[model samples]
Target chain A: MIETDWLWGLLGGLMIGGAAALYLLVNGRVMGASGIIGGLVDGSARDQWAERLAFLAGLVGVPALAVLLIGGAETHLSGNPAVLILGGLLVGLGTRMANGCTSGHGVCGISRLSLRGIVATVFYILVGGIVMVLARHVLGWI
Target chain B: MARSLFSALAGAIFGLGLLVSGMTDTTRVQGWLDVFGDWDPTLAFVMGGALIPMAIAWRVAARRRVAVLGNPLPLTHERVVDAKLVIGSSLFGAGWGLAGLCPGPALASLGWGGWGGLLFLLAMLVGMVAAPAAKARIDRITQAA
Candidate 1:
């Protein structure tokens, strides 16, 4: 099955868009992934904890479900887990410094025409682009 | 019992969605898009799973008179293209490439409670604290102009 992934990309964008609306409709909040994750750390917010747990479980679990039904495995994460850990830390710091994750700021924020989101997302893409360059071109990390 | 819960739930779901979509693994994402070697469709399913519900929700929100959370529906209105936008986007991209995960996926990775997730989570905290101060300064300058 060889074909273009445009349909998938469009579909994904729309789904994410729909999520933006739903988050607004239900929670009156932007579906900013970074902030939600941040809320889980310090406070004893139980709902936050439970939903976060469930959602992360679902994120990993759903793939498992898919594999169970469809017989495919998760993509191989090639980097050493140690490297992955270090990468995760840097990303977290970046997200916080920027005020939202790609989903929150890049997708929903820009969609809303938020200046902050617009600015932040631009930096996000560019920084990611640059890092990709360095990792692959310079350091060969990618 | 109250409205605040929706914020938390929605946020969590969004985070989870990021994880399932395999956006957490930067290499996988790039690999899926890459035409070089092995191609992965994991991101495709992840996107589909999210869109199916997302499309439904968008319509629901569009039809609703008031949000369940008692907040106004989301809207967009802006055209202020400035230096901040350029600088910020570049920073984000560089960081993402360096780490192979963004904020959402990084946090979801943390659910495993591994040391890597913890480091990402902590760095994110540092960024969060710094953002507000920067925002305020930018707003002030914008207001002045």
Candidate 2:
């Protein structure tokens, strides 16, 4: 199961990359989730709202359908409401402020060798690692 | 019409990839982050696999002025690393470490994550909506200094 997990992760990641490539090639848009969803409400990309909505529809609907077909997906999110809310807010604000996330900066940015994407990815990953150390090991707050 | 269809198709594939990659599992994400503890390196393969094709795609894109659909390509040229990028990424990283959720997996896992996922999504949307104001505030402070 462990080995298969790695194999599947690679395969799945390939699919994700393919999807992003297709979006860029066919639609000429960077396929960043936060950018897509956030732009809609923020009016930054208001003109392309249709394309964004359509993409989000597929993003949300397909996963739900897949779960129905393959049974429920697994998760390990905290049950604490406070934790969930705070985490959600941070993710939302931070992605918007940085103008990207793992998909934008981590995948697309690094792939294109864009300096901002690379720097953002490095900072986020490093900070994430540090937070994990503090929260999970040292302080045990999480 | 074609653009919307392609966008939707891409989103579907992306969602499926998230599921197949086991990224929908928070434990797996947390495991990857827990380098001091039982670190799961499966995510490395995921990033590696995704990068190969994406790098190729980017290379192809670098040569093209427009998309195959005749739309203008958005090539981000900004290279300035400033406070917003650093601060925002730091906050995002902290949040991700706290909850093991990012926008992609958070939305993808909605079906199974139940109420927690919904609440998180809502709160995230609120934060996203408020992001503009937050940016304005930051600008104000930066300018005032």
Candidate 3:
């Protein structure tokens, strides 16, 4: 059966991609999602703060807007809020250690054929795979 | 001039493809490969869906002269494969599995009242800030070598 998830994935992809591209085009920066948020350290990091907030706000607001404008999808965060919290901490650390988030490194960096980026991306992907395995296979945590 | 713009255009499209493939969803992503044997098979389709659009976008972008922005897209790069790669990868994996989040989606998920996304974002900055010092040490050793 055709899945609504697919459509969500498609349109959502386009919105994110479009924003990243536009952000880069206008600002001439890597569309690293983390960097944008980091800029939120102050009221707004000049253009950095403004755009970052907007981008992040857009990330949340847009999706909500989309669901409101169009419809809602089945996406929901499961597991414990504690899990999500712990998970976020690890990811924050990992992205820093890796020097780029998925959007910055995984999408922007890899596309540029950056060797360091590629290597780092591989690390991210492999680790993601391993974690998924351990979470279910070993830890028995969904 | 045109080339760089076009390249950016292509990259943006590729990213969108990744998003569409459901790669941005932390739970769905972990769900597909959950090794405890609850293996969610949907991730493969996400991968496939991404590849499809990616291939097509590249082919079209490749044929263009000056990108839509009137300049060549800078495709310059640096490829470093070293000890850092191994260590960095290991850390990234550990963090990801533990958090069930990655850089992209974690940031994206912030919209959904993602407390996890916020926490991850915080740590990610700490990590990036530290990367320079780590790189400096690596540089020192190499110089001594």
Candidate 4:
């Protein structure tokens, strides 16, 4: 299962990279989903709303429609509503504050070797790891 | 016209990649974070796979001043490494660990994740909307300090 996981991960990652590359090559925009969506909502991206909307239509619409076709997208979300809300707030606020997220900073930023991207990724992962340890083990909250 | 079509196509491919890579699965993501426990290194492979093509693409992009659709390339990046970047990323990371859902997985899994995904997404949007105010307050505090 682990070995196959790697294979799928690699293939899927390639697809993601390809998608980012295509967005860059064709659209000339960094393929950061959070940035794309955030821009639209924050009033900062109003000028490019059409393109952003189109991108999201595919980002959201595809998966939405795909489950109907392929039928599998199992997610193990937490049952606790509080945790979900807190987590959502943190993700939204933090990604916006930092100007990126996993896709923007992790994939696109690191690929370009941007210092901000690298630093953001490292901090987030480290903090995330620490939080995971505390929440899952020490506190047993998650 | 053409740009919108391409953007949608890119989004579709990206969503497909997330689904294929098992990133949409919270267990897989949590497993990767559980380094001390039963760690799953699959996420690393996904990152590796994603980096290669993206790295190559960046190189290709470096040569062109504009995109195929003739829009100016958006390649310039923030060079500063400040409190906002560190604190924001750290917060985001903590939140991600708390709930195995980041923007990509959270949005991508909406169809199947149901109410949970919907609620999370909604809350996240609220956070996004509220971020500017928070940042302004933080900036004022920092400046005073």
Best candidate (score: TM-score): 4
DockQ of each: 0.29, 0.80, 0.29, 0.85
**Chain A TM-score of each candidate structure, as shown:** 0.81, 0.95, 0.80, 0.96
TM-score of predicted structure 4 = 0.97
Residue B79 accuracy (lDDT) in model 4: 95
Residue lDDT tens for model 1, A1-142: 2354444444544545555665667665557666565555534345556545544454444433444566433333434554555455555545544556677676666544567776776566555655566566677666
Provide the lDDT at B8 for model 2: 93
Docking class of 1: acceptable
Fnat of all models, as shown: 0.33, 0.77, 0.30, 0.84
Please provide, for model 4 over B39-143, each residue's C-alpha lDDT reduced to its tens digit, 9 standing for 90 to 100.
989889999999999999999988997999998887687898877888899989988998888898788788889788888899889889988888888789889
Q: Which ten residues in a row have the lowest lDDT in candidate 2 chain B?
A: B74-83
Tens-place lDDT digits, model 1, residues B23-121: 655565655443333756655555444445545555566677467757676543345666445554555566566656666565444544345555655
**Against the true structure, whose lDDT is highest?**
4
Q: What is the C-alpha lDDT of each candidate?
A: 0.55, 0.86, 0.54, 0.89
Query: Per-residue lDDT tens digits of candidate 2, residues B1-145?
Result: 9889999999899888988998888788888888898899878888888888888887788789699899878775678887788888888888888888888888877877889888888888887888888888887888888
TM-score of each: 0.64, 0.96, 0.67, 0.97
Indicate the worst ten consecutive residues by lDDT in candidate 3 chain A. Answer: A39-48
Error of 4 at A74 (Å): 0.6
Using TM-score as the measure, name the better of candidate 1 and candidate 3. 3
Off by over 4 Å in 1: A2-4, A42-64, A67-73, B1-25, B31-65, B71-91, B107-145
> Taking the tens digit of each residue's C-alpha lDDT, what string does model 3 give over A1-142?
3367666555545545554555444344456765555444422346445445545554545454443565433334444666665565555544544556666665566555567766776777777778777766677765
